[model samples]
Target chain A: MSKLNDWVEASPERERIYAQEKLIVDTAEEIWEAMDKLEVSKAQLAASLGKSKAFVSQILTGSRNMTLRTLADIASSLGKKVCVRLLDAHESNAWQSVDAVLISRRVAGFAEVEVSNDPRWSNVIPLHKESCKAA
Target chain B: MAYSLRIAHAVENISRNLLVNLYINSSQPMDEYHSGSSLTIWLWEGAEASWAEAEVGVMEAHQAQFRARLARLAEFGRLRVPDHMNSEGDGIHAVKGNTGLRAYGWFDRVSGRRAFIISHVVLKKKQKLDPADLAKASARKDSYRLSKESK
Candidate 1:
């Protein structure tokens, strides 16, 4: 951990920050897979991201939240694009539609973690507003 | 039973500076038997709070005191608190190789009992608390010697 303690530290740009955020939440396994497939190293990630190795350590160790754009740049470096979509509320459907949604979080060519990407939802969710309120 | 400590603030600081995407959040209570992915230990978190109950950071020396107390609880068959509070990954042992990190805390699903609830964005070992881990217990020996008056 750097001797720092706050997020007020100087940052390059918002676009970069957003990109970094997307990467931070990525699964370590996913990142490892992407890097392994592309033949990249932590040093290369830092060099491409224009950050220090120490900073890269923070990002990889879940110590940082890279912005969406920064994550996109990192992905782009790897030849990937972050993708997203929205699911609206349908009156006829059992589930209520959401007003707005933040669809895809892309990392250029590296990898993507999306709602549709994962297929591990096995539990049934009852569509009851009261239950929602209780939860 | 179990407790969840927030180390996100600390994690955020490190990531913003270093620029990495590793993050860990507790989706299920620590008591929930860890399956392939029960405890949410992700590398990033754009905005989803699925597994992350909160954030996590490295523990300070004093905070290590809390870990020791929590450990004593477990030693007496009470609750075992986790050693590395907000560390990412399964038991510290897995993270540290063989001379691995000591994975503390106990989990009991029979009644949904969790020791320490922890979530971490960064997974670095900050301080070595093991060196002085049991030092305090040994120091009090002189004072805890049956308390001459009580004997």
Candidate 2:
């Protein structure tokens, strides 16, 4: 009956829930990557874990907040273990030190060559700059 | 006489460095208006997942929605978020999914182009963003800017 132009904005509570959802998604991805490395499939993983393919699919898509028991079961089946750490302020400093060196290296490397050679190309190219003026 | 030659050589070195910096600064602006140059996404060392990898880490339906939102961000030069989602004028933008997914990052201009650098990904269980997460993102933005300047 009603048509909305943009997606509905999230409430504070919804934001929190989405945050949890993101965690499940990230965990699911890790599990998927492990399966890939181990050369396993959802069907294979399901059989090994004595679970159903549908359940595995749900887990991978973050349809539910998986219990630690389920996660441990999945990890153990895949020859892995779950390690959780709550970092202290000093310890968590390591997370913030997301070394941008790699990114900068890529940019600077390109700049060294491109900027040095052409002396005209921008260090980074803005998308939609030519078409849109506001940005 | 020998000292004079050495002094002249030192002046030449300083001048050469200055010229290089000037040349880089002058040339970057002209290329800004060119079409077809795509935006760049940089992940941190420990955040070692390709954008595709990160995309696959969510629900099947949400993945498409996430991508569509990203497309809008690229088109608009900034990702859209509810006004309440912003972190107090810190330039950080966030997108919240109806399902459980939130992406947070800040925008930085590189050579007149905007680069959206993600500070952290959160899985919330509470009603408010952890102040620490905001700090982490802000720190990352600062580090990125500092690195850019040093270059």
iRMS of each prediction in angstroms? 18.7, 14.3
lDDT of 2 by residue, B52-134 (tens): 34445565456444433443344334332331134534776664443534556776655444555555555544667667766
User: What fnat does each of the candidate structures reach?
Assistant: 0.00, 0.00
Q: How much lDDT does each candidate structure score?
A: 0.31, 0.48
Residues B69-147 of candidate 1: C-alpha lDDT, one tens digit per residue:
2222222222111221333223221122111233322122211222222121122254554423223222322232233
Per-model C-alpha RMSD: 18.2, 19.1
* Residue A97 alpha-carbon offset, candidate 2, angstroms: 39
Q: How well is candidate 2 docked (DockQ)?
A: 0.02
> Which 10-residue window of candidate 1 chain B scores lowest in summed lDDT?
B33-42
Point out where model 2 deviates above 4 Å: A1-135, B1-41, B48-57, B79-89
Cα error, residue B15 of model 2, in Å, equals 28
lDDT of 1 by residue, A69-92 (tens): 766776677665544333342221
Residue B40 Cα positional deviation in candidate 1, in Å, after optimal superposition: 12
